[model samples]
Target: MTAVLPATLAAVDLDRTLIYSAAAAGDTAGLEVVEFLDGAPLSHATPASWELLAELAGRALLVPVTTRTVAQYERVRLPVVPRYALCGNGGVLLADGVRDPGWDDWAAGVAGRAAPLPELLGLLGAVAGQPWVRTVRAAEDLFCYLVAHARDAIPAGWLADTAAAASAAGATLSVQGRKVYLVPAGLSKAAGLLRLRRLLAGEGPAPRLLCAGDSLLDAPMLLAADAAVRPAHGELHEQGWTGARVAVTAATGAAAGEEIVRWLIARA
Candidate 1:
């Protein structure tokens, strides 16, 4: 286990954690859900959940740590501004909606060591030698993910080995839904979150860290928190949640978010 910190904070994954995008399916961005209806299914945070988040906002800092680029993040829109945000899998840091200068230097320093997209694409093509591998696309400045039509096409063991190979080459591979992400080894929600925690350590005994996420990619952040929550669905659910507490919510993504808010309120 990582050492407990001196100050506490909440590091939450945005999609399916606090907000459910229109595209809930892994193969397709939730865009269709929004397009079919007039807009996406973003119900306002339940009153109790909103109150709890507000309480956390005042008592301890709330950071929206997500795998979204600043531009994409700007589009979904949040109910309230967070004190700090880690965007694009820690590629960018924002303080009160404005990009932080220090983080720019940090991103540049880290990006220098990561593999470029062209190299990553080549590796993906070389290793993923099968017709089952249907589509591959890049996420907003984070990295590329491959969608497979046949789950049995690549054995889980092969996926593990492939991920290890990618990591050795300075990238990470995380399978979510029908896709596998090739993220830079340096890009993680935990890295950016630890940086924010360090900045606030002097304020009080390191605040307890609380986090929530849906996939294996989120495992690092979830494990790093002082306490955490996991929804009914997601890779973490199948493996079981190791956080201090787990919230079993409705099967749907939007309903799970409501459960998260309720969990905070009950504890608060």
Candidate 2:
């Protein structure tokens, strides 16, 4: 018989990983910011997903990790269940609606080393003039990102240039779906999770960490997990997934999220 695994924690990406963004491949009716499906056909989540998440919520801590700023995340208005949340790419941490002070300390420490927003904005300004970029905007938190027309719209070298510039400034940049983001190198989802682990798990041997996402930006958190899951689509899937335990899911939105929860709950 196989050895049984210990209890585990599930760290999930909010946007593409759990909830579907309002912007569908062919549909742009509600792409103002980001939209979530409550019960529509193109909705990113389904009833099954809610049931599964509720189950996991009971068994393991379900952390909603997203790049959206704390205020932006508030606009999401997800079903209010008690769960820890990390918003603004780990810039702010909240537990059951209250801001956690420790996370602010961690954010300050990370920001102290990251490149300033001015430098990144300058590069983005140059890139914005390119024909490929339709619109660019800064998050309420001051991070920069752009809505590009397509992958081929911008020269591949532009991504390289941005990465190089970000590197020089000690920052990190990534493009996911139609949007690109400039995040401080040290303020990553993995780092935020580690801080939570330290607070909750303490010095005891770490419990298995289960994570899932769909972008290269998610690679660090996925790699750090004891087991990880990904959908058949997304940047990570296109490049091929090769590390850690993985659950390959269907390409559809809610279906993929349901599959991830199923896989994690089964393992737990």
Candidate 3:
């Protein structure tokens, strides 16, 4: 009898990591549109990367962990349907295309331990009239974020000041690209992944974890993984973030997406 290998859990971030917008696609040509808005092309991945992702999905439990809203996440057309997905920065979990009620209850408990979303939203409103602030919205009813017209135009010390205030209120702050996120300190991708891991372990031995991402929000998830990979671009790279087991791709944009998929497949 042959010894069975433990399962592999590959959790990957979507935007800027596995997929890119036209503005971020770099030199990659023949892009496949992965996301559309009102029938207009919005996000894309290289044809090669798409094919590689299909192969990876067949090999491991492919979990797309993203900060995108549930509706926004459904817009992306991946070659394979993932068994599980964590969206809204772990605020929502989808199991077999259905929202898991148990996870929802767990998330509600986590939210209860933090400052209420309405209060955080009120704090955000105070700066919504700033010239550089483009739009402000609540994400999945769990946190809030503001879009800036230009990343550099954001007021000096605003991020630090807001982060400090949020911390005092039991929230956390992160600036990824042109978006500033104010999420609850008790809610994180790592926490969600750990819950999923426990649920998955009930079927058998725990799987070996591999994670990939390109933003500050991804750091906790990456750090929680047994092995992690990050694209050479995006917010994390911009801040020179790294970990003991984190591997980086040599390329940027769609090419980096391809490299990450290949790395996952090889490691799996």
CA lDDT of each candidate? 0.66, 0.72, 0.87
Off by over 4 Å in 3: 1-6
TM values, all candidates: 0.73, 0.83, 0.94
Model 2 residue 85 lDDT score? 83
Candidate 1 local Cα displacement, residue 230, angstroms: 1.2
Q: lDDT tens digits, residues 80-153, model 1? A: 67867888787788877899877878876675577777677666676556778887666654567777875557
Expressed as tens digits, the lDDT of each residue in 154-260 for candidate 3 is 87588888888899889988887778888998888888987888777875678899999998888999999999999999989988999999999999988899999
Q: How many backbone clashes are present in model 3?
A: 0
Best of the two (1, 2) by lDDT: 2
Tally clashes: model 2.
Answer: 0
In terms of lDDT, model 1 sits at: 0.66
Most lDDT-accurate candidate: 3
Residue 68, model 2: Cα distance from true site in angstroms: 1.3
Model 3 Cα shift for residue 133 (angstroms): 1.7
Q: Highest TM-score: which candidate?
A: 3
Pairs with steric clashes in candidate 3: none
